[model samples]
Target: MNRFRYSSHNLYSLLSQPKSPLHPPTLPSQTLVSLDPSSIDFSNSNQFHTNSSCSSTIPSVSSTGSCPDSALASPFSIKFRSLHLYRGGYIDKGLLVNLYLVKHHCYGTSSSVNQCGFRNVGVNELRYFASHKQVRDILGMIRRKDNDLESKVRSMNVSLNLKMCSRFFEELNNQKRDALAVCDWIRYAHPSCRNDVHSMVIDNLGRLGNYDAMARVLSEFAKKKVRLVPLAFEFVSLSPLKEATVMKVVDVLKAVEEPTRGSGLCSLIKMFSAVGSFDMAELVMQLSERKATFYKIMVVEKCGKGDFEGAADLVEVMRKHGLKPEAKIYNYVLSTLCKHDKSAEAGALFEEMLASECAPDPITYEIFVCHSCKAGNFDLARKLLDRMNAQGIEPRVSMHGVILKGYFNLKRFEEAYEYVMACDRYICFPAICSTLARLYVKADNVIVAHNLLLELIDRGLRPDQSVYTNVFRRLIDTGRTALAEDLRSRLSSIGSKSTMGAG
Candidate 1:
């Protein structure tokens, strides 16, 4: 089945030249604009109420990914023709079968990524993409070790082939075959693949209780003249750290003429630290002061285990050890806190960044604002926006859109209306303005809504016929015949009614 796609670019064109900012319109003598959405009987399939206004509130707003229920026609809604419904969660028949029949799940298929397919896509993930005959053949080749098919797999994307081959090797019982499969993929499928592949093989061997083969694989990888990736040290730690293995791994690390490249030595320290060889990790760290990121890695590891306090302590330890934490390191910690909704802790981390003189960048502030808005705390979000402006960082449209969305979500329409009015200059996108106007018209604030619609015209964003007709109809119904007639004449002057919404 084809999927829906939406773009931020305007869907309508301007029919007339930009006008001056719209002055407030005169109200009708009689308050006759009925906004009680329930007054209209939505049960009658043939019944179309002019005052029926059911809205998810924001149109042209990006779909939140999750779907929502569409209500009966609301007087405020100006939809041309669109009805969203999940067809019992069914898709194309062939694609549906393809989803379940492959060897490994292809979690990253172009369409399935957006669909509710399994995430992480290991073990059974190949099934998702193996619907392709060539893909299935590649999977078969990897399993059967058909060396002749190497070129075929190589022709595919490097990352993709690597994933399939890696999955193939992981299910192997023989360590030598596993090692051979990885080498086969690298030598044929993607000779230019990074040392991470070799490390992956070594890690796999260790997981399979084949330390001897793991050591052999490491030796073989070392024989290659290419630079070893940081993952080399990681896999070494994965294998047994016996006298021979430890010495072998240490020799590899020490023999490297360039220790800083790819943070090889730092990775060694991290591996040692990760494997409970902290004392060795520290001793190895003494060989290089460029272990700032590794220090953060340890902090991150702490955060992963829910030891946020320990993570913070690790930062202080970093200072004591003469390792300066960069803004990026602090950012990782801050973002993690925000992700976990630890707002109080995130605030502290921000203060700590300022205190440490590790200047926070625009990204740091943006994360804070996004999380704040997502939590529906518009007050904090607004304050953050103000703080960003005070710091000379211009606010982003995404942030305003988020805050406005929060107001609409909370059903705080009055506040949302006032906020929209306050930022009309910045909220210049025709779609968003029209959406807000629709909301206003639904709420019986037709005059305010009409003013906003005119404001769009002045800003050079002329909404189409549906929007114009809807507003005009509401205006006439509310006894504002003068304003309605004037608008009708203005639209007719250019003969633009037919051209409106044409886009």
Candidate 2:
């Protein structure tokens, strides 16, 4: 899951000096040659040629026969075995996994047992690591518009598949134009999957609320007379709708023939309702047949705007239309009632939801717990937390944080500490621990806060940088220069980015 950031300086480091225990015993003809991936000019086909004197140290490969055609067999072939890649003073799992593949490819089904009996890193384990690295490298090349990108990929024997391209596209920063460039390359490389790739672009644009870029893409598709993909509309269904964006969508839909255009209009209606444009959405919905869906979305929007009565009235309207409201619709109303101090009404509605066969979800309980904490009713919040556990619904960390904040507000530090400790060990405690440390610092108990922060670090929990910075600044002001510097170094080692530079 780790996306490696590559640089020329550390692209490939020399690990030629063999280490005992980690490295296998030397063979008669085997000599290790580290391939510095960054230094190789992948545009040169000759770069893949094997040196006659050199032989793979990897077991099962005979020292004879022309070395496996080092040139990329196809766009997807990767020379995983030829490179010794290392970063940050440790062997990456990618190298180990590729080495496993090399041995397997050499051994084939001749034997499940490794002939050389090397320690198995498990077959195909960390395979994605190597593939991700190669994909990222290609993405980087594309970003720089490197003319050698195609040659490099083919020369390095790296495989570019649709999945890898999609992942790299998702990881691209929220720059739509940059994503568009990548999308074009993907479309050219994978003509068969053009719609799927375009869907990704539209999803990214909608997720970022970049309607301008989305409009351009839609316009280009219309110009090309490409049929609008149904999936694109699905992605944009929850996006915030604007007049200009909707117009562009309408223009594109005019070209796409029936059925799909009909589906697209439905999604457009949902998009409008999602953004609280209920009146406009209702007008659009007149062209569609999904009355129930539109009503549900409106109820949620009404609750969001704190119009509890309006949301409740919409629920009655749904029932009149023979559409049963879901737990989510009731939950929104409950949340609004609680927010408006209508706790009695919320309680009644909760009972009604249960009676109507609408099972309460995690959010239903979360709403009550949050209200209880805000009302300073710790007893009720604690009971609600227990009920959530009894119902097999795990309370999120934010809920615990909320209760802890309540205790800290009442200056009940002992109870807060005990409560956190009593919670399951599996529950993440960094945020809770950070809140405690910050409280100590706020009370002018700098030494206690500093000590607590150190203990949390030893427990492998990272405190927020704000608390660390505060303690560091306090230490300096108190003339404890060495202590202040040590804290700063510790912060740097933890890789926490601080707002202020070390002073």
Tens-place lDDT per residue, model 2, 170-262, is 565433334664566555444446656676666666666566777677667655545444456544455455454555556655555554455
Candidate 2 wrongly placed segments (more than 4 Å): 1-287, 291-293, 316-328, 356-361, 424-426, 458-473, 479-503
- Measured by TM-score, the strongest candidate is 1
Off by over 4 Å in 1: 1-164, 167-186, 190-198, 201-238, 242-289, 321-323, 335-344, 366-377, 424-457, 461-503
Cα deviation at 153, candidate 2, in Å, is 40
List, residue by residue over 296-345, the lDDT tens digit for candidate 1: 76766666666666667767788887778887777777778778876556
> For model 1, what is the error of residue 2's alpha carbon versus the real structure, in angstroms, after optimal superposition?
56
lDDT: worst 10-residue window of model 1: 8-17
